[model samples]
Target chain A: MKKLFKFEFRKLLHSKSFYIIFGLGLLSIILFMILGRVMSDFVGDSSEMYNATATMLVVLPNSGIASLLGTYLVLFACSDFSQHTIKNIYARGYSRTSVYFIKYLLSLAATLTVAIFYVLFGFVFTLVLGGHVASIASYMWANLALQFLVLVGMHGMFFGVAMICNKTGVGIIVNVVGIELIFTLLNFLMQIAKIEFNILDYYLEMILANLMNSQQLTTAALVRAIVMPIVYAVGFVTAGWFVNRRREV
Target chain B: MKVMIENFQTNNVVETENLTKVYGQKTVLDHVNMHVAKGDIYGFIGKNGAGKTTLMKLLLGMAQPTEGQMKLFSNGNLNAERHRVGALIEAPAFYGNCSAVENMKRFAILAGADDNEINDILQFVGLGDVGKKHVSKFSLGMKQRLGIALAMLGKPELLILDEPINGLDPEGIKEIRDLLLRLNREQGVTVLVSSHLLDELAKITTRYGIINQGRLVEEVSATELMQRCQQKLHVITDQPAVAAKVIKKLSPKAVITANENSIDVVGITVDSAKVTKELVKNEVAVQDITFAADNMEDYFIQRMGGKA
Candidate 1:
């Protein structure tokens, strides 16, 4: 099992797409850091007033981090077919169960790493920019964790669809069209119906919105946000395993 | 007890009874039956789209047979026995980001290999030096080598390889052929190989089952088929017509077909001295007498009726 994990890690690290996504995220962090420093130099510190203005600037763009995590998920799940490497993995002694879980674990690990860095960098930048850190850390962590779980779970759905289709293109299309566009639209309908369906909302986005503004949100909304994504992640991964095992190679 | 005893007697390494597969209206495999013995290098020979790949896929548990029953190693337990077998269904593809060792390790886990055996298996396939360097950087031949290495992992007793030597240069072909022979002869691994290269397969196979139109036409040991597919000996002599006349009386079953100055005697056991004596007795000045037998290519072409 350790050997299998090691192999999966090595493959993920060595992938050009992995490096590409990481590089893009790293570049964005650097750009934000430079921008924050320049803004602080221009508008002298008003720390005596203890304003939340700088915190807003730093954390608002963390949503871009979510999009970055999303893109990474897309590429990582699709790379098996894009590179035509699934057969190699299948022929090896690892069960399909292990393969499915390993992919999920790697994607989750990646999302967590990026999410943590995004929050940490945003907080440190805001402090240097002469603004109070606020109670954003706890909320940011909560929001990022929810998004990571959801993204990882969504990636599981992508992985499952890819296994069933045995082609990367179909997986990409399903995620882009079905999950991003179609499901998002369905989520809109649920919201408009006023049927008391808060779970279908963009939980990460809502939490990020509350975090940036330092607003006190309802526990019911927060609980729905956290629990729904975990369900998606677990449900998608289980379905993927079942489909992969039963489907002919 | 009678039923249990009957089951024990049918212990073939691979058996398919009336296995059929159809893609829409076209039938790729039509009720094909195959039986391969344990520890046999069963060479599967056929033309393109002859269902060799389909048969291999069925045995490897990659694709379901549309009709009929498929069994492996005396039981219908393909998935349970899959760990004991390794297969390469088509052109071996590997993850570009992984090194040869890393790729092997991933498959080793999937195939259920112990931790200590990964390095040994990599070395067996000549990828021992593949450290840190990703498979993307390896040559095509190297990838194919890694594929075989992965297949040999877990010390799998049964190996199913599809076109194992395809895209390989002459040296590459020889290397793989030697490796396979070693695996079979030294380790007692049973191999089922499918190839369009009949001559190459003829060199190392223990037994061959020729498939045409998705059906097996014949199954015989290589040694048994060698007499019928041996190398042809062409005899060129002065007074070819007179030499042929005398040689005909000696080897009655010999084929007396002529080229320019040579008479071709196919499928016959001929002694050079005996042919010389007979030609001289007929007053035919003997210069040189050559004898030739049918090679594997000739036999394949003749057997396949010159079909592509």
Candidate 2:
């Protein structure tokens, strides 16, 4: 299993798509930082604007990290199918379950790596631009932890879609349209119906928003934030594994 | 029944009994019973969509058989013994953007082969100088060679190659043929290669399994096939039954088919003079005699019920 993991991770790490996505992510962050600086200047009162900019950095994980990592995982997971390289693994006696699990673990690691790079660079850029770092230190660590879970949960869903679909175009559509548009539409309908609890909040994006925007994390909210994403991660990954095991490829 | 049976030893590298594969309403492979002996270059002959690839897939555990059993290396547990076998079911599958060595290294790792052996495998497949050239940039022949290199990674005991020499030049074909021969002769590796190039397959194969419409029509050895297809004397005689009896006495193993006006004597190593003498001794009169032989293509055509 360790050998399989190392081989799979190396394949992911050396892929041209990995470098392309990583570079584009860095460039986008740089552009956002520059835009933040310009907005602060135009709004006047540098210290107040700097605090706002730092708050924006904290909130960046909510949307930016999940979508970027989700897109990458969707593409990465479907590539083996498109290229037919998965045959090599199975033909060499690796179990389909092991292959699916390793790919999931690698996707998680890739998401973490990209997220860490984004945060480190965002922090350094904020300091260089003289933005005052916000002091929500008490809950900041917990927020970051919750954000990590959200990333995992989102990637798990995308990975499952990629494996089940086994086609690049279908995977991308499921990740972008199926998850984003349909789920958001469902959430909006629930709100219009005046439902007290939005069931979609148990999913990745809603849980991420709740974690990032809530001023004081309640015990129930905290439990949901931690437990829901883990559930999503495990449930989707297990589903992907099951499908992979039965799949002919 | 003319199928080849060279080595009479009890060891069989691959054996399948009534193995079937069904896709939706279509049965792609139906009750295929195939046998491949150890150290034999078993040629799997079939036309397109004749279930050749499907059988290889079942043997490799890439797809499960709908019914029946397949034993590899004397074990029916394919998941456990599949590591001892290496296969290329169709066109070589790899990360086209990665170099040949890189692709091999990845498979080698999965195959539990030492990383250091990648270079040797690449060299063996005649892709030694393909350094750093990504597989996407490779020619069809190069891609095929790299696929072979990938299969040879762990020094597997059994090799299942599907249309391996399809896109090769004559020289490339010869090279691969020699390579397969070397592997079989020197390393004792059993090969099950499927190809439409019957002539090329005839050159190196020790045994053959002919499949048609998802059914195994025949399995033959090189020597037995040669004997079955060898030139024979066709004698037109006034008394074919009497002539046949006379010839059978001289060449007991001769395959003789007696018609009203003729007796076709096949697989017999006797001269026409001896046959005539024996017939005269039996008081059977022969009017005419002719010689004929069938090449592998003709034999295959005849076996498949086509006009040969």
Where is model 2 more than 4 Å wrong at Cα? A37-63, A131-136, A188-203, A216-223, B1-10, B234-245, B248-264, B269-281, B285-292
Q: List the global CA lDDT of all models.
A: 0.69, 0.81
Report DockQ per prediction, comma-separated. Answer: 0.25, 0.65
lDDT of 2: 0.81
lDDT, residue A4, model 2: 88
Q: Quality of candidate 1's docking, in CAPRI categories?
A: acceptable
Fnat, 2 decimals, each candidate = 0.38, 0.64
Chain A TM-score from candidate 1: 0.71
TM-score of 1: 0.71
Q: i-RMS values of the candidates, in order?
A: 3.4, 1.3
Top candidate, metric TM-score: 2
> Compared with the true structure, what per-residue lDDT tens digits does model 1 show for residues B91-118?
7866776677767666666666765788
- For candidate 1, the per-residue lDDT at B259 reads 66
DockQ of model 2, rounded to 2 decimals: 0.65
